[model samples]
Target: MAKYTEEEIRNFKKITCKIAGDYLGVSSMAVSIGMRNDLLPIGFAIKKDDDRYSESWSYHIVDERLIAYKHGKINELQIQNIEKNLNTIIEQFEEMKKDLLFILSEDVD
Candidate 1:
């Protein structure tokens, strides 16, 4: 991955998945999946449920975190913190999923 200066990254109105993926020499889907799975600490990946059968992903990357991740500056402590946060998010998502399922089942009945 090539290192990007803060100024260069700040110039972008939005740091999209494609832009980040290009810098990291990976496809946009790879970037999205990485972020979703908490393997990449460069950004936030939110999965949006558009309907019962469709979902889409949205990403919001922190410029500083992207630069730090690209430059290999993310410390072990930060990684641990990210993991902790990821776990919490997973738990919350599970709860939300269960609630949605219950609501849908009621509609089906």
Candidate 2:
């Protein structure tokens, strides 16, 4: 992958899985799996439960982070921070899920 400039990276609102996989010379599934497992530092992969037994993944790739990761510029500290933030987000999501469940169970006249 070529080194992208700040302006070029800034032009993207969010990088799609296909685009990221193409840049990294991997399949979209590989990218998704990597993000889902926290192996990729470029973005987030949120698992969305569609039904009782089915689920899908949603990706949100930060362009700046992707560029930094592609160029090997992300340090261990940055990766640790990213993991910490990801954990916080997961906790918040779990709380939101609980709130939604409670709201749905409430009786309304």
Candidate 3:
């Protein structure tokens, strides 16, 4: 896999499994399980083993993959599931927007 510099990473529009799940109208755990079971494709996994409490891991999926999925390029099963759960995905997106607004409104002294 190709390695990206910090600056490149900063500019990249990466999404987490949790957020991907939201986009897919599924739970984060379902997304995780799919990845583990090879039912989903991951562009790469970044591991941060230096954390004291527990090893931190991040999965990066290519933007193209997401776009394709959004455009019905994925498997039939996924397409069906996504269509069936569209409402949930929209709700998640709304909730995330609210959360972002709240965070941005905080007073940072």
Candidate 4:
């Protein structure tokens, strides 16, 4: 139910940009601009297959220009919760797919 304002998002992007620049020896402008231009890859997902489960994660990114938020983007605790939820979904997928013929794609034995 909670959401982020455009200004707040910009602020976050700005802070992130600074942090990234300091640690990576990259340009802060790159990060800031990436955030502003919608160039950041922020989505997170977990993919599962028969042999193994794949983890692909991205943040719930709002448009750089528009800025948005759900329940998870507000704080560290919420972010952890969101990540956990995503991971859980992947686990459920693995469990459900374990025995399904369609999941294996091809029979090994």
Candidate 5:
């Protein structure tokens, strides 16, 4: 994990799988799989509600998860998990990104 200041962590108001992917130049599916398999940090922001299907969550990659992934810190299983067809992965990633944005904004007036 990367050491981050309190304000630095809070400054990351909108980190997500896709955003992490963007930072690392990989598909969001890769970040998602890494998180699901515990191969990477689950990020700073978390879901307030248990309903994953609901637009109710938050996230901030205040660690080296993205850099780790980029540097080949992931394992074979993680590689396989993110090896989906490019089109499907990109589409799904986009939708998920939108959903996460919605979740993050649900409380803001």
Candidate 6:
């Protein structure tokens, strides 16, 4: 697994909000509001392909240094590991078995 530096994570967040606001039809401020109100769920903002029903990427910064990625559930121990600069947060960073759709799509659908 590739470990992302803090700077990379910041850039990724900027890009994510841009994608969400420009293409996903939601403003970055709106996303922030949602998060403040416990509305953004995982603090994830994403752009999706309606035709394919697929996500590009989605994320939420659990803290100043940690981000939870698309299509996977982040665990507490994993978060701690990342805080310790362990690079790889979990045994698996991405999972194919669990459907994030059923969980996250309630905001959209």
Best by TM-score: 1
The TM-score of predicted model 5 comes to 0.36
What ordering of candidates by lDDT runs from best to worst?
1, 2, 3, 5, 4, 6
The CA lDDT of each predicted structure is: 0.84, 0.80, 0.64, 0.47, 0.60, 0.46
lDDT of 2 by residue, 5-87 (tens): 56666686777877777666788788889889888888888888776787878999888777787779985479798779999
Which portions of model 3 show Cα errors greater than 4 Å?
1-12, 45-56, 75-109
Listed per model in order, the count of residue pairs whose N, CA or C atoms clash below 3 Å is 0, 0, 0, 7, 0, 0
lDDT of 4 by residue, 1-109 (tens): 2343545555664334444444334565655555444454333222334445654322233344223222223544554677799999999998887868665766655
Give stretches of model 1 more than 4 Å off. 1-6, 79-109
TM-score of each: 0.63, 0.62, 0.42, 0.34, 0.36, 0.26
Using lDDT as the measure, the top candidate is 1
List runs of model 5 lying over 4 Å from the truth. Answer: 1-11, 42-60, 63-109
| Residue pairs clashing, model 4 | 42-58, 42-59, 43-58, 44-57, 44-58, 45-56, 45-57
Residue 10 error, candidate 3, Å: 14
Give the worst 10-residue stretch by lDDT in candidate 3.
1-10
User: How accurate locally is residue 54 in candidate 1, as Cα lDDT from 0 to 100?
Assistant: 75
Misplaced by over 4 Å in model 2 are 1-9, 75-77, 82-109
Clashing pairs in 3: none
lDDT of 5 by residue, 9-84 (tens): 3467666667676666567777766665556653443556777676554555644445554567765465455544
What lDDT score is found at residue 101 in candidate 2? 85
Model 6 bad stretches (over 4 Å): 1-16, 44-109
- Per-residue CA lDDT of model 3 for 1-109, tens digit only, reads 2333334433557666766666666777777777655577534456677898996766766655555664567764765576569978899999999998888889453
Per-residue lDDT, model 6, residue 16, is 47
